[model samples]
Target: SGSTQCDKLTSEKTELTVTPKELTLTTENITATAGTTTTLTATFNDDTLNTGKVVFKVNGKTVKDENGKVIYAKVVNGQVSVEYTLPESMKAGNYTITAVYTSPNSEKLTAEATLTVAKASNN
Candidate 1:
């Protein structure tokens, strides 16, 4: 039996390179009253690729949406700011908020912020 033979071919591939920029995260308030709206901002210098894809989590849960969905805020000028009202039932304690930014090349950076929830006074 005669069979057609194929030649093996090999080519060199180049790895694209990019410079990483420092990503910073901050919030308008380190403390908030129960059921009050607060804001958190994540900034990336010259990070046009992953700025819009930033995801924020509060106490291990995503922040945003009326139904408490995982989508919140939007990217503008290499930054995404999220405004959310604290849960009324939230206990008076320290809470954690985290923001993660992942690049197109799969490189990721994460930053965290703390929020102190004050108990509502029964005045």
Candidate 2:
């Protein structure tokens, strides 16, 4: 049998930092029907990271509000959200909603969500 030697380990304070470069989007319900409204939220490493604009898109096209106006989400505090109304004429199909967060330097970070549209009600 051999005796083992004991060694002391030292501890040091460590700080970890991360730079956010990715943007993500999420919704409570990904599936929606035509003529219905849904909410989408975009998130990033920092809310203040976006200093320019957060453009929202749908089906590779820009989304509009109930007033038929284009909508853009601005990061307040750390996140941005928007409400979009699906066109009553929208056909039943798979659609993609995207959020493009633009930085002050023109670098764009994009996030997207999916929407499965169903046929409108007969009533």
Candidate 3:
């Protein structure tokens, strides 16, 4: 017995839209007095699950909690924040604040901002 078979192939063109990833860091309190606490916020913009942690740094030094452990803030709805208290003895000047975002499904992103610390009040 002899059998014959025929195959047909079809293709369709598709388009994909790509956008650059972005991360922004800012301070809720742009200026804070020494010995006072301020909030650092990080927001991630990407096409993936935006749940991750943020590592904060000040003046090129990693910020740590009182327990001597690295502080990591949980990201919710693409935003995360942590409180940082300016040292009482810190000089009154501008400081560079940086935030690094880490996630299991996305590449690491970083952002920087400036914070001005004022001299503590003498009240």
TM-score of each: 0.67, 0.67, 0.74
TM-score of 1: 0.67
User: Quick one: best TM-score, which candidate?
Assistant: 3
Candidate 3 weakest lDDT stretch, 10 residues: 20-29
Specify the poorest-scoring 10-residue window by lDDT in model 2. 20-29
State the lDDT at 61 in candidate 1.
83
> Roughly what TM-score does model 3 have, to 2 decimal places?
0.74
- Model 2 ranges off by over 4 Å: 1-29, 47-50, 66-68, 121-123
Mind giving the per-residue lDDT tens digits that candidate 3 earns over 1-123?
744575665889899899855555444336888888888887665434457788988989988988879998987777788888877888898988888877767667788888888877778
Prediction 2 TM-score vs. true: 0.67
**Model 1: which residue pairs collide?**
none
Query: Which ranking of candidates, highest TM-score first?
Result: 3, 1, 2
At residue 16, candidate 3 shows an lDDT of: 86
What is candidate 1's lDDT per residue for 3-122, written digit by digit as tens?
Answer: 469667798999999976656554433788888888777776554634446678888887768975776455567778777788888989998888876655666677888888988888
CA lDDT of each candidate? Answer: 0.72, 0.73, 0.77
